[model samples]
Target: MTKESTPNDVTLAEPIEQEVEAHSEDNKVSEQEKKKFEKREKERKHLVSKLAQGNMDHLLTRVASVLNHYQETRNSDITLQTRYWEVFQSDIYNGSVIDPKDMYKLERLTSIARARAKIQNEFKMFLADEEVQVSRRSRQETEKEIQLATKPEIPLISMYCDESGKTGNFAIVGSLWVINKARQTQVRDHFSKWKTEKGLSAKDEFHFTEMKKHQLDLYKEFFDEVIKNSDALGFKAVVVDKTKIKRPIDEIIMDLHYQVVHQGIEHEVSNGRLALPRIVNFFKDEEDGQEALYETKLKQHLHSQFRLAFDDQLTLDLFNSVPSFQNVYIQMADLYTGCISRVLNHPKQGEGNHKDHFAEYVLELLRLDLGAKNDQSQDFAMVHFFE
Candidate 1:
């Protein structure tokens, strides 16, 4: 400062000192930035680790709940039971202790168990209600007072016979309801209705033809009604007119026997035996011409194991002993003949027509057979006889 310095020296000295100070400042700022960045990176890593741990815990809890639910719902002997046990054992091996937060998962599982138990209880209640209703209805029927005649030692069996006339166009059905006391009023009233609804008024050919169809329909209707009243009437047996429909009858009989065996109807009867009355068909007469041929073929097709023969004495005796039999026998001789006649008269319709008609007959026969056997035997005694 005392000696006057040169302008160049002064300029050089000032520039060097300022440059050093600026470099020192830049170094300090870089060191501070590095420390801040390292701290932020460490915090991010810690947060990611915590989030990953939480997700893993949540997944494990859900898995445990599902496994517990499966074990509870599955059958005791099922393979799933073993599998769940294995998983539980593995979890215990790894770490038996569960975190307090996982207790909620266990609670969720318990809730599901409670809901399942409630559903089971509701289902049982529903079943009980249904059983109560059935019992009430049965009790009402049993308590009703009605004058029922003492059942004969040998039950009365009636025979209902029917036949089809010329070309199977006309059907004739006859019912012999055997009454031991012979209620003339009941018989007269019933016959009057039957004759009006099913019988041919004029003996003319045309009237007879119409009567045949009417008779068949009426027979079916009557048979169904009698069956419905069988329990109330205390009938021992309900004999269906098998006759030309032996094949159909056999099929129905077999089905009834099957139902009795498989469906527990036998256990419901008085003697643990289903007491479906015996069903038999009249032997077809050879003198019946083509009708006889039809009967023979039908028997062969339906029950090849048995042979058919008409014995007038047997038929007459059976008819007369209706009072000794359980229920009435229904005959569809007229309906069968009429169907045959219709088929023969209309031959141009092709073979399918006969097949269709026969199939329909078989189906109807099956339905009737099943209906008769349904709940008919309480003791299911028929099982021993047939099985």
Candidate 2:
């Protein structure tokens, strides 16, 4: 019952031919990819060689933190890679040597947006390793528990900021300045006592527009306290007039924020106000897609304007915190800005909102120059107007 195969039939030759051709195709593709990768590596090495001669201190000293806050998990390779390239370019621009491993890391870090948290963790671990090595060189370490117990935390000037009416004609950034560690706890305790006396929880949130009808008095008391202690604890605001701007809303907002923050920090240092070991400015997380790009840009502008202009001695940390958390300081910014927005935007609202009244009343209380522009550096607040 066996039948002999026909000569025209494929038998094994067609599959064998097809597989050989496929193999050849694969080899061709792999060769091409290898050539492309090599070319890219060569170009990167060339760039790094050129960049190694310049100022590399920014690489070791400057901190780039991304919160991975955009909420989207899908990796955007093109954008991320472009950012990595940007980071690589900056490393060289700052005169840092580009090792193969770091270039590889840059490739990995820039390839996926979700890798932000992982990158930060790895960076932290790297810093920790460096600390261990430095300690080893100086002296032998004790057990892990002992080391952990002895680790000291460096105190910093914490600046909590929030913005309101971002899309409206007026944008305001309000800031609450506080010292970290024990002093912060003391201030929080005082604020909490005021809240408890007003029949509110210490954990209760404070927002002006959403205040209950009876909470008006509580709001007034809090504002008065801020104004009263405006010396020991500080609150400041920078306003932007958007009606005069011709750019898109998002662009305008980012630029104004940068200018406000930039000018604000400079205003502080110029006046001998930023007298702490370091400064950490926390703003609400706004950019979901371009968090890394935006954070890097902001930090660069701050460093360029404030740090480089001086001795690069100042350490500025920019971080993003969720707006709806237990950040009482950010709430302070929101409450302060809410008051400013009401008075500045609704000049015609007769019988002003008490928050607005409090704002204007504070100006009178401090005797700020009514005739002078708000942009003038006052002892308490400095406002920036875009020309």
Candidate 3:
């Protein structure tokens, strides 16, 4: 038997029933949100585990490298880690962040900072245990490597190389070093202007072999301009006497070329003309009919030398071979190398011929008398006769 409800009871039950339904709906929403949060937490933990185990993604690795460089270079007590973490805490949690990406980056970088600190502390402990000796130079080199790997900018110098007398009594490798892009432009402009005045187009390349008696004055003037701009221009040459080579020329030519470039850089660094942490871009005149990739081999040789030579941190960038006719700098290298080769290879043709006169004039300008071996330290120029 059911009792019939009164109107007053119905009104009271209506309000209570609506409240219960609303409460149930709220509980459902809360449960769904909880599941979503749990999934996100699980994913985050997996990501963190991966990062902790040295499975850093590219972004993490890059950020870690950058932080490492800052630690090495910046002398501060607070550290980038502390400053960045404070910002992360204040801005991210407050929801006052400008970009959402900042949230993830700040968190990741802070983690990297922590990891780096831990690794360094452990390394110190390891060194103590092993009684290892780390020289100041080694530490500086490591810092340089970090900077080179992570920094956005670096100082650059261009080296234009050309070979001469490869088949003759003496093989000479000459290179013209231009400091920075501004100097490269300045040199090109000056050379172009001189060529225009001499009724020559951009296509008219300068070569020692092409020099005539009539062009001696022009050639002298050209070299004079070069000497005048000695601050921006440097010349280095390595002359190898073929008589001393026990092996085939091809077997040793690469090394000879490498020595010329390497010693040239060393000389500049020693003289304080070029500073450290520099990259050299090497451009060589194209070799005719050689099956070997000369530029690639030269680049590899240079890399190996830098890797083995503890003293040098100088890096090599673009090692390209281009036509001598296309580049004025390479042509200049050719002219210089050719002059040395002619003087050294054919001693009998010393004074009478135009080539001899021009070579002699160049040697005089360099303040070097023609000899079997000569080196000029003045005016940012060096010529070495390899023993």
Clashing pairs in 3: none
> Where's the lowest-lDDT run of ten residues in candidate 1?
317-326
How do all the candidates rank in terms of lDDT, highest first? 3, 2, 1
TM-score of each: 0.22, 0.55, 0.59
Off by over 4 Å in 2: 1-155, 179-182, 270-272, 285-311, 353-355, 358-373
Candidate 3 global lDDT: 0.64
TM-score, structure 2 vs. true? 0.55
Q: Determine which window of 10 residues in candidate 3 has minimal summed lDDT.
A: 123-132
Best candidate, TM-score: 3
lDDT of 1 at 36: 74
lDDT, candidate 3, 195-263, per-residue tens: 888898878877998888898888888888888777887888888788887877765667767787778
Give the Å error, residue 211, model 3.
1.6
Which lDDT value does model 3 have at 127?
17
- The whole-model lDDT of each prediction reads 0.31, 0.52, 0.64
